[model samples]
Target chain A: MELEELKNLWTELSDELEKQKNLTDKIIMNMTQQRYTNKFEKITRYESVGAVICFLVAIGILWKFEELDTWYLKLCGGITLAFLLIMPVLVLRAIHQIKKLNILELNYRDTIVAFEKARNHLLMIQQFGIYLSFVLFFTTIPVASKLLSNKDFFIMEKEFSLYVLIGVVMVFLYFFARWGYRSYKKITNSAENILNELDNGV
Target chain B: MTKEQKFTELIKDNEGVIFKITTVYTNNESDQKDLYQDIVYQLWKSFDSFRNESKISTWMYRVALNTAISHLRSRKKQPGGSGIDKIVQRATENEDQEFEDRLKILYAQIQKLNVLEKGLMLLLLEGKKYQEIAEITGLTESNVGTRISRIKQKLKSRILKS
Candidate 1:
């Protein structure tokens, strides 16, 4: 077909397109408004688990070191425990805010956006785990020496081993956070590229 | 208006942008609709980052083409059938209709072109200049001009044969 002929056809099609614009626009608007629930759920689950672990660890620390009577240890333990208890609740609230309501289903684009947001949230949560690990590892030293002084060799050795274990876990969590961040970046970039293609009319 | 409301208005105004692109790229109504929705969803997700440096339509075009190309690539990975097969099946269904007969044939022929060739022809058919097509498709301006001339001749001969 000649260029002019093609242009004429496109002109006719464009007219038809204009008629559907309102309907199409509504669909787009609705789809864009819906959030991806599955990603939000996953984030919530991870955060909840992190909270539970931190809480249990805090309880154990408080019970084991109760005899030491050190204000610094008590304060550190209380703060870590409080943060551990609160982090999951905060994450859950954020997840709820991003969830799609019962009135509508999430569209493809909204799902992508939701997933990106969830990924970022999870990455932040992972960072918190790193910070907690540092606190636990460093604070355990003075607390362990003071509290474990009167304890048996077996108990002291076990306490030292547990501190080492916490350090290893922190290192793992850091790498995991890095990996999650990279994956989120990759998916977002690919999604953006696809959007660009659609915009160009190719 | 709220940010979301403003965003919706923008989509409502420019939806034809997606519709026209999908119509040109897909041979069937269903696929066209799917591509259109995909494009819109992508645009909405990226709306927050949109600066006013370029025309909204220009930005929309860039996003839409990138989405379509990525969709094309991913669809290539599926088994049992390809997007081309889907297009051809739709085109063949229109064989009996007089008005659509020629357009169907054209679409079938267009589908036979490789990715780059199809991009060039689609832009040419849309009346984009060689320089504009070059900028969009990342081909040199001279190369775009040469390719469009070649594709036009090739398509004309193919349509003539039909």
Candidate 2:
């Protein structure tokens, strides 16, 4: 139970481990041949795909800039365009920060602290995206309807489609944001606990 | 030797460190295997950038330790679980039951430590010097000393009480 006794046990274990290798060279070689993924790879892919879609939509709006004949439509178009253009960069930048952690290169303290900061940045962006998405939701519906469907949502006699689009986005955003926030909070809390242990041990 | 060959060689030489580290960070057998592969993958991912600025062991420790801790953050920690016994059973399948039981007990005590404490204790138990521990963990030597002593006392009490 003593410290030295524990060390002795560890020594015995180490000696045994050295003699008995679980991972053979063949298995390790296969491991080297295999590709390993980071926990954030999925997020990176989603963000990247979202960015591309946003960029494409922004381009579509620009390609059909003449469709914005009225002042209000243009304003709505402008708002949607800006959000589409900016959100991806912010999201991708956050993803890039996480990718840049370079865990293999940094020491434990730096890696954890950097990881916490990156996660906080990401969480902030996600929360900001969620809240700001409502405004985008309202603007994008009209602009997208105008550009893609050639239907003026405001002037249309039948407003059922606009309401349906709004309902869908509202539902999707509500559930997705709620889930993303809860999960990210869990991950951040776990990282923060380790950071606390590092600063104040035992 | 080629880069992949060298990395493989180094990993082969230090396979036990990775095995032991993964075992400590994770409780379940599947997770341990996943973490072992993850650490090797990270090591190779960063292998090209190693540059020999520090000792290979120190560098490997940093990578393995960081990867293990990061990998654990995503999953829920299940302390005081029966998973360690499964790993012990497999690791010591050919050895005597008494040694396996003792190993299981040691791991159980370690599983109770906090993430940071676990890393510090693993380094200490591996016979790493204070300077090397400080280097791998990016903590000042004095701070490592303080934390290790406190963790040591804490572990001793927990073991004795149990």
Task: Give me the candidate number with maximum lDDT.
Answer: 2
Please compute DockQ, using alpha carbons, for every candidate against the native two-chain complex. Answer: 0.14, 0.53
Candidate 2 lDDT, B1-162, residue by residue in tens? 887678778987898888889888886677777788888888878888888889989989999999886673345556564255544434433757777667777787787777777888999999999999999998989989998998888977886788
TM-score of 2: 0.77
Q: Of the candidates shown, which would achieve the greatest DockQ relative to the real structure? A: 2
- Model 1, A144: alpha-carbon shift in Å? 49
- Estimate, for each residue in A105-154, the C-alpha lDDT of model 2 and write its tens digit: 67888877787778788888887888788888888767877888888878
- Interface RMSD of candidate 2, in Å, is 2.5
**How accurate locally is residue A56 in candidate 1, as Cα lDDT from 0 to 100?**
84
- Superposed by TM-score, candidate 1 places the C-alpha of residue A24 at a distance from the truth, in angstroms, of 5.8
* Lowest summed lDDT window (length 10), candidate 1 chain A: A101-110
Give Cα-based local distance difference scores for all models: 0.57, 0.80
